[model samples]
Target: MIQPIFVYGQHILEQPCTDIQLESPQLQNLVNNLWDTMRNAQGCGLSAPQIGLPYNVFVIDSQNAFQAIGKGFRKRYFDAEDKGIQGIFINPQLLEVSSKMWKAEEGCLSLPSLIKGVSRPWQIKISYYNEQLEYRIQEFSGLTARMILHELDHTNGILLINHMGLLIKKYLYFKLKSIKKGRVKVSYPISTR
Candidate 1:
């Protein structure tokens, strides 16, 4: 089922998520919901907190992101096809990230209609439990790494707005307020209350 994403001003999105019990019913449900909700909203990633669960879990399908961006990066980051096994990282740890960074405009399902330039490490090493509850350690670069990092931030109670520069933030102030006030429009379901 596609659950409504918690928007800005929602307490749940700001609260840090806790580690999920491996192979548990709650874990499975959250995984399913994250996948469904992310695909439904056309998002590259989704975290448990985005859908009201404060558990350490997030899903990433950077292939879609890569496809949208075009041919140049298709093979550089991930398999653009065979979409059956997307990254469903549970109890994920960002053990390493390169000092070299890439700045890109980032957005969130929660904060719809908002995108800001945020600099992130170009490469990363992470460990997590897969969909089958198997332990895995993987390294990623380019869009895949960026997607994972963005979702990981959600589990840590960090939003894209937090990474914006002063000028960008100042420019977005009233627009953000409009979102918080329910005056802005969003395609996906969001709970701002």
Candidate 2:
């Protein structure tokens, strides 16, 4: 079932999420809901906190974002093996990050109509459990790494706005206020509590 995303200003969005038990009965359902809600909202990634759940989980399907770009674009930044990854990350940890950095504009499901430039490591080493409850440590780079870092921030109670400088936040003050007031417009469902 598709769940309504909890928008910015919701207290849950600010609180850090808790780790999930591998044996939790509702784990599968939660992962499914994350995927369903993300796809419904046409977002490449969705975190458990986005749906009012405080579990340390997130789902990503970078293929959808890749499909939107042209072949030339893909060839420039991606390798032949970079078809994209689709999976659920549970109890994830950012093991390491490369010194190299990349900056890009990112929009979040919890912050509709807001896009901001954020800088993140160009590559990252992460340890996480898949939906099957299998643990794995892997390295990711390019757009995949960017998406992972964005969702990871959610699990840590961090928002894209936190990356903004004082000036940018001042400029977006009213817009953020509107979102917190539940006045922003979006195609998918949203909850402000």
Candidate 3:
């Protein structure tokens, strides 16, 4: 199912999610929903919280972003059998985010019709349980890393708005207000509650 994104001003976006059992049928459904919602929105990632589930789970498929990484993206990450490196990451814990920072204009399904400049680490190291309950530690860079960091923030109840300074927030006040009031037009479905 293509689940609706829980937009800004929603309490779920502010409340940290809890980890769940690895083998639950509901967890499988949530993962499927995340993938579907992300693809429908043309987004590189989606978190459980974004779909109104307070579970520490997120799905990332930045490898699908052919333009961002060029046409050879699959070649870079795919194996001989064409199995690409991307999927649901559960119970994610940020092991480290590099001190080096990169600034970019980021858009979120949670903050539709809006794009904000935010600074994030250029690289990250994280540990998490995969959908198969396999514990893994991984490092990533480029937009892949940025997307993971962004989705990881969702699991911790942190919004991209929280990363902005007061001045920027003030500058975007009207746009943000429009979103909260459900007046902004978004291509994808969103829930402000």
Candidate 4:
């Protein structure tokens, strides 16, 4: 079943998530629900904290239509396949990052309407354990890199709002109020404050 994705400014996104035990069924459920919620919301990735789960699990699907554009060269190099709507990561750890940085508009599933221009590394190499507890290392670039970094931030209790300046934060604060009143189609998650 799809779970409710917690809105932005929730305390959960600021607290580090616990690492998952490879053999735990609770970890499996977290992976499942993250994927379900990501797909249901048409998101390219989701983290456990976004759904109020405090586990280091996240779902990524790079094959979505939006990712196809501006990613042709990257696709050829990564050989990304249609992984059937979900790639689950458990206890993911960032190993290294390239010096290249890319600026892009970033949004959070937890913060629906909050889109901001943020700069992130263009590529990263990450090591993580899969469902069967086997360790794997993969290189991600471009949009995939951005998605990975965003989800990983959730595991570490970071949010895109943290990157926003004071003016932007104030803007979102008032916008969040309108969302709470149902006056707008919420673009970011409803603030818990």
| Candidates arranged by TM-score, highest first | 2, 1, 3, 4
Ordered list by lDDT, greatest first: 2, 1, 3, 4
Instruction: Give all candidates' CA lDDT scores.
Output: 0.83, 0.89, 0.82, 0.75
Identify the candidate with maximal TM-score: 2
How many clashes would you count in candidate 1?
Answer: 0
**Could you estimate the TM-score for every candidate?**
0.90, 0.96, 0.87, 0.83
lDDT of 3 by residue, 1-193 (tens): 9988888888889998898788777988989999999999888889998999999999988656633554565454323343334778999888988988878778888888677777888778999998788999988776677788899889999988998889988999888888887787767888877
lDDT string, candidate 1, 90-162, tens digits: 9999999999887877888889888777788888899998888999998878777888899999999999888
lDDT of 4 by residue, 1-193 (tens): 5776776546788899988778776877777777777777778888888888798889887667444555555553233552223467889999999898878788766666678888988778999887677899988776777778889998999888888889887867877665445455543333343
Model 1 weakest lDDT span, ten residues long: 76-85
- Model 1, residue 124: C-alpha shift (Å): 0.5
RMSD of each: 2.7, 1.2, 3.7, 3.7
**What's model 1's TM-score?**
0.90
lDDT of 1: 0.83
**Where does candidate 2 have its weakest 10-residue lDDT segment?**
75-84
